[model samples]
Target: MKYLEWRINGFLEAVNFCRFFDLGYNGNRFTWERCRNTQNWVLERLNRALATRDWQNNFPNAKVFPVESASSDHAGIFLTLGVNVICYAAKPFWFENFWMKEIDIKQAVQTTWEHGKGQPIAEMIKSCVAYLLEWGKNKKQQFKAKLKQAKAQMTRYRNSSNPYHLQSFNSAKEAHLQALEQQNIYWKQRAKQHG
Candidate 1:
């Protein structure tokens, strides 16, 4: 109970620090439950939607309610902005910054652009985009295959007692880490573009 209180206090402090107010919910009061139909069953209002004053003013009629789910222990919160939602069409082309790190990208682009000579600027752009998209797709597939193989090797060598196996495991582990770091950078660049 003391630990729970401490956590609650910390949450409250954070909320206050952010100047966020809870958007009161409707429907089932408890958002989570466990040990259903047993003596140890517990229910808790663990989930909530919060917003700042500016947001509240912008969408004064926003509403939040809990939706019970049969497949999960926690209820999903549904929020309505109480206004018409505008759906924007996705952009046709997005150049990933992470692609710049690839050694072949510059050469690939140069070759593609060279082939686009004597065409309109727009046509050249379209051709370059098509080539880049295909190139990016191939790179992504290769990375995934490399990562999978590294993971398999790491697992195979994980429990071996031989020093050679240990060295192989370490090499596989390093390859796996490098692949993951590259993937992380790719996603981070993508998130920045979208966000």
Candidate 2:
């Protein structure tokens, strides 16, 4: 209870540091619940909609409310700004640094570039980008499939009672760890690029 209070106080301090005000919501008082229906169950208002004074003034009619969710532990917060907003689609192409580690990436880029010979530089770039996006999509799918397979195999081996399964379990576990490491490297690079 003391730790929870400390955390709540720290959160409030951070909010004050940011100079943001909570847009109080209607409906359920608690936003999150854990171990529901049990004696140890817990409920807390862990989420809030915050806004700067300028933002609040700009959208004075904005309303905030919580929508209870049956599928998730936390309720979803909905905000209405009393204004129409247009949303734009995100850029389709982004070069992932992790792609450089793949053996076929260099060859694939070269092939696409060669295929666009005699074309304008912009045309060649567009072609190469289109090819890379398609290739990356396929690569990502394959990587996810492989990782899923590795996890499934590890789980299967782990549940067996036979001593013979130990070696197989170890191999599967190693493969899973390596896959996770590769995924970690990809995300770390992405974070560095975005940050």
Candidate 3:
């Protein structure tokens, strides 16, 4: 129990110090498994990839998977940090379906389209796209700020032993989880990959 508590505390401190989130896994959860009879075997998740928020944002498609290891008791970690970029002869115009879900998307699109009425079709399309891209940039900045604030709040609660703080921490964690889930879904759709 003491060893477990120490490990937990060490993990929490490392997470806070490095401002990282575990990228989770695609295969087995436990990385370490004692080679013994079922009654005596022990399993623990001892390996993982932890990345900072900026890393998570930059490598949105990054995944941590367990690789089969024959030389050791622990499974090897395979961290894939590849970005998919397709080269095209002619640039294709693509609009996100999620843009319609934003509250200000209609106003922004309408205003941009109206202002470019007299311009050529290509120019007008370009103007509207520029406006929408700016809006998306602003939204991303706002989200990052909120995420930072939540992380700080959670860190404070984690260090406190107070029951009230613990309850608040749980709520904060739940909110963070929900936000991450939504983000994962959006990225999965964009990347055309399964979670």
lDDT for each of the candidates? Answer: 0.81, 0.77, 0.71
Model 3 agreement with the true structure over 1-195: per-residue lDDT tens digits:
699999999979989998987899985677787843345678789887888989889988899976544246676788988777787777444565545545787888889999999989999999988887778777656545655565557657854657899788877756655444435445656787334
Cα lDDT over the full model 1: 0.81
Which regions of candidate 2 are displaced past 4 Å?
A: 1-87, 159-164
Model 1's TM-score against the true structure: 0.52
Off by over 4 Å in 1: 1-91
For model 1 the local lDDT of residue 54 reads 98
Candidate RMSDs in order: 13.0, 11.1, 13.8
The 10 consecutive residues of candidate 2 with the worst lDDT sum are 66-75
Higher-lDDT candidate among 1 and 3? Answer: 1
**How far is 63's C-alpha from truth in model 2 (Å)?**
27
Instruction: Give the TM-scores of the predictions, in the order they appear.
Output: 0.52, 0.51, 0.45
**True-vs-predicted CA distance for residue 147, candidate 2, Å:** 1.1
Deviation (Å) of 177 in candidate 2? 2.5
Ranking by TM-score: 1, 2, 3
Tens digits of per-residue lDDT for model 1 on 1-195?
A: 699999989999999999999899965578887874356878899888999999999999999977544246676798999998678987577786657757799899999999999999999999999999999888888777877788789668855668899899989877776666667678788788779
Q: Which scores greater on TM-score, model 1 or model 2?
A: 1
The residue pairs that clash in candidate 3, if any, are none
Q: List the residue pairs that clash in candidate 1.
A: none
